[model samples]
Target: MAVEILIVDDDPLIRQTLHQQLVALGYSPHVAEDRRSAEQQLARQEFALVILDLALPDTSGLALLKHWQEAGTSLPTIMISGTATIPDAVEALKLGAADFLVKPVDMFLLEATLKRVLAAQALRSENTRLKQLTRGGRVDFLGDSPCIRELLAQAERVAATEQTVLVEGETGTGKQVLARWIHARSGRADEPLLAVNCAAITETLFESELFGHEKGAFTGAGERKPGKLELVGRGTLFLDEVGELPLLCQAKLLTAVEDRVFERVGGTRQMRFEGRIIAATNRILSQEIGKGGFRRDLYYRLSAFAMRLPALREHADDIPLYIGQALERCRRQYGRTFEPPDDNTLRQLKANSWPGNVRELYHHVERIALLTDGPRIPRSLWLSFPTEPESEPTDIPTGDLRTAMTGFKRKYIQRVLARCGGNQTEAARQLGIERTHLNHLLAEYDGRR
Candidate 1:
């Protein structure tokens, strides 16, 4: 990607010379003879830097600068003039011109100034990115559900091997927690566990984040920085929400996943990926592949040993355990404590479906703890907490049991589908029904829409 440089000057000779100079310096330069052409160019394209002759045929360069200022536009510009006075240079600088050069512009100085301004821009961009990106917190398992016990057993078996692992489930089902569990149990537990949030990263930053970049790879790249893949030596690279990875990155990652090797951005040197990859996603990749959103080859390569974490509702018996843990955490974090709920309160808590799984439960408990003044939280709060809505549709009559039963089944299936975020596969698994059966029922209910 060549850096675009816009040259606004009336001198054909100077424009041609500067164009050749910019090209020789590995830039793409566009020329405009006057202010009209310059404004047109600015409207049509994005330029990294603008070179403006102080004495344009139509207007003074300062007037163009004022136009930029009044239009609420701030373009990085370098002002050039054959007869540049000290006052003219000061005015250009005040108008946000990055630099002022006397005519017969020094190409070396131009290159150096370009690097300086671009480097400053990159630093500012990186600082802003760093502020936007936040590392997620980790929460380990703390439940006695048989579903979790089975998942643990499976994780242990997979942890013994060096094969890549993929964990799948609904949101808040402890996918990352399971990834951590696998990492801790694996042979490379001593090495650091590095992670990257696939969904949070912008596409431009994706490659540099995973495979690093050589110093001076791009205009503002500066010093070389090692990415997660390089940092997680012989350890685990936990790619969270990997289904959201951009197509370009998916192709880039295939080399690392399949060949166990990668190259830094703009560098020919190849590096071996000695670490294991444990990617987790809440998405159904099969559906994404059918929709052409995910690559089938990448999916196959990643799912060498795939596992699904059970939704919290599947293990309702563990609700008490989680509730108690949430209260204790609230105590530790905010110095708020509460009595253990009575059996009826426990029953109500268990009755509601926790659609967001353990994460939602913790937040719900914390909210109640923060607002309630007394040790005993009001039971009304528990009652108000959402439960699976009543599924009986009014159209069904009370006199006909067979027809009424059919309506109940349809409505119940619809409720469960909503709980599973409308994934027929997950909804079927949740309802303890075959996918074909769910599809068949959905076909009949489609007319009700």
Candidate 2:
């Protein structure tokens, strides 16, 4: 997200001009008519900067700035006024305003001042770094679908323990989010949560990345560095796509996890890890184990507790909630507000297949919100699935039963997926097979293709 600024002023012209100016400069600018609206915006969202006018309908802007300072709120603020004396500027500065500008604020001056203030804030504290990662604050699952509610219930119970968890689902199903959900409710909520992408790291670097490597440990090792397990302290270590980890690294990881102790690469000293482990994967490890790609024992250890995040199509009833959440985020991050979808519009949203899950749905909502200029979204601006042609049954081929059945199954699955708008889960449900089994069959078909 870009830098989001809140412009608080009572003058309609000043608000409109500033909003346009900020947008022209590639900044996200939200507007508030008075102190009351300003407070509401601040409470609901985190802003990078505030451009406040001296006069507000309900209260003087100086008082609000002073209140923020005294309340220990950390926000870089600029105070602007048309009828201000030099004394007002000094008072505004004393009230902890980043800069004071006389109204008819110069565009160059405002831009330069904003840049200077933000640059200084970045170097001032570690909190600035944390703000980007957790600007949303505590995350709450927005959907009330049965699958979501059930997942929340299970997460609440699992979060009470220190068990190793393995989260499984399709891509963009919010596996890492579920990890955060658990860690936030766990005993280690105060500690940091760190993640490692098992699929991204090379086989040679995997061990050293999981466990700290000593100085001169390998060819590129110039100095000792701590790994995620060490840096996480008593927090949670999230291993994303854990099933893709190299077999050699998995064996080393199993021992370290089982014993709760690890040796730094090329070092004799043993280090014990006290942090909890949470692994997530889009792949089904049981299927991977059968294919000799993932370790069975490691899978067992990680699966001490396992859960799957439901695909968006499975929880289609929650489409409205997800769309609303996306629009709310757009309002916060892009200063864009969208009207609620009408009953028929929402029904279309619920019925459409979301093949890419929640992430994809969020992006689609954002796109529509950005494009819609009217107060209400256009009913015609809805997603449409590509319809598959009706597949007719064919006479039995002269091939053997095994070959005939294989070809039939492949074509049948493909047709079903097409009918479901490329939704694998729905296709699997229709075929009365596990989603993982369907995935394997698809993988086989793709390999042959």
| Cα-based TM-score, every candidate | 0.56, 0.58
Against the hidden true structure, what lDDT does model 1 obtain?
0.85
- How many steric overlaps does candidate 2 have? 0
Residues 139-242, candidate 1, lDDT per residue (tens digit)? 26777888888888888899999989999999998888788878777786666677789999988999899998888998899766767787676778899999
List residue ranges in candidate 2 displaced over 4 A: 1-136, 384-449
| Predicted structure with the largest TM-score when compared to the true one | 2
Where's the lowest-lDDT run of ten residues in candidate 1? 130-139
Count clashing residue pairs in model 1: 0
Q: Distance (Å) between predicted and true CA of 57, model 2?
A: 59
